[model samples]
Target: MALALSLKVAGLAAAATTILGVAVGFLLARASFPGRNVLDTLLTLPMVLPPTVLGYYLLVLLGRRSALGTWLLEEFGINLIFTWQGAVIAASVVAFPLVFKPARAAFESVDGQLEQAARVLGTSNTAVFFRVTLPLAWRGILAGVLLSFARALGEFGATLMVAGSIPGKTQTLSIAVYEAVQAGQDDVANTLVYIISAVCVAVLLTAGHLAPGRIARR
Candidate 1:
C-alpha cells in the first residue's frame, strides 16, 4: 500500500512537472525578456532551498488563513493541507527544477535553424515546436522526467510537513522508513530503505540510458 501510494503521488507529480517544466524550459531556452533571469532564479530556488523552507512556503501559500486557500476550501470545498494531493503538490514543486534544468538544456541544444525553416514553410509556432523541437529533444526530456520522478519518490521533509504522514493515506515510502526507525523497527526500516534504494537506482539507470550522449557514445 505504501509503495503504491508513493508511486501514485510521484507519478502524478512527475506528469505535472513534465508539462510545466517542458513549457518553462522551452520558454527559457528560446525567449528573451525583461526579468527572465529573475524568473529562472526563482524557479531554481527550490533545488537549493532546504526542504523545510520549501514546505513552509507551501504551507503559507496553501494554509487556511491565506486568501487562495480559504477560497479553495469555501468555494470548491477542496482542501490540500494534510492530504495526499498536498503531498503531490509539494513533491511536484521540489522536483520541477530537476526536469526544468535538463529540459532547458535539451531545448537549447536543438538547432534553431530547423525551427526557422519550419516557420518559413508557414508552420505556426505551436505546430513547429510540437513537431520539430519536442521530437528532437524528447530523449533528454524523458531523462528529466525520470529524474523528477525519483526525486519526488524520495521527498521527505516537505511531504511530511504538508501531508503529515497519515498511514495508508499519505505515508509515503520515505515517511514509512522514518517512522519505522523512530519506533525501533529496524528490520522494517531496513526493508523499506532497500526497496526505495532499489527503485531509485532503477529510475536513475533508465534516465542515464535516455541521456543525450548515451547513444552517441555507443
Candidate 2:
C-alpha cells in the first residue's frame, strides 16, 4: 500500500510538471519576451541546484510564512507544506527541466510551412496548431513528458525534505529505498533499486523510439 501510494503521487506530480513543461517549452522556443533569458535560467535552475535547495525554496514558497503561501491559505484554504500534495509540487519542480528541453526541441523541429499551409486553407491559427503542428511534434513532446514522469518518480531528496518520510502518504519509492539503505535493509533497497532501473529503461527506450524520424513520415 505504501509503495502504491508513492507511485500514485509520483504519477500525479509527473503529469502536473509535464503540463507546465509543455507551456514553458513552447514559450521559450517561440517567444522572446523581456527577461526571457532570466526566465529560461530560472526554469533550468532546479537541474543544477541541490534537491534539498529546491525543496527549501518550495517550502518557503508554500509555507505559512510566505506572503503568497499565506494568501493561498487565507483565500483558498490550501496549505502546501509537509503534505502529500507538497510532495507532488517538489517532485514536479525538480523534474521540470527534463520535460522542457525535449518539448522545446521537438517544437523547434516542426516546419513553419505546414502550419502556414493549414492557415491558408482557412484553418485558424489555433486550429492549425492542434490539427497539424502537434501531430507532427507529438513524439518529441511525448518523449519529454515521459522523461519528466520518470524523473518525478525517482525524486528523492526534494520529496523527502519537503514531504518527509511519512509511510502510506508522502513516502515515494526513492524515499523508501533511501530509508531502507540507511537502516541497513539492503535486500528491500535492492529490490526497489531494480524496480527503478526497470522503469527507467522502459521509459528511455520508449522515448528513444519516439524521437524524431522514428515514426514513418507523413
lDDT scores of the candidates, listed in order:
0.96, 0.84
Q: What's the TM for model 2?
A: 0.92
Among the numbered candidates, top lDDT falls to 1
What tens digits encode model 1's per-residue C-alpha lDDT throughout 93-126? 9999999999999999999999999999999999
Off by over 4 Å in 2: 213-218
Error of 2 at 190 (Å): 1.6
Provide TM-scores for the models. 0.97, 0.92
The stretch of ten residues in a row with the least summed lDDT in candidate 1 is 209-218
**1-218: candidate 2 lDDT, tens digit per residue:** 55676677768877887778878887788887999889989889988999999988888888899998999999999987778898888988998898888778877888988888889889997897689878887888888777887888888888887889987777788888988999999999999899888988898899878877667563
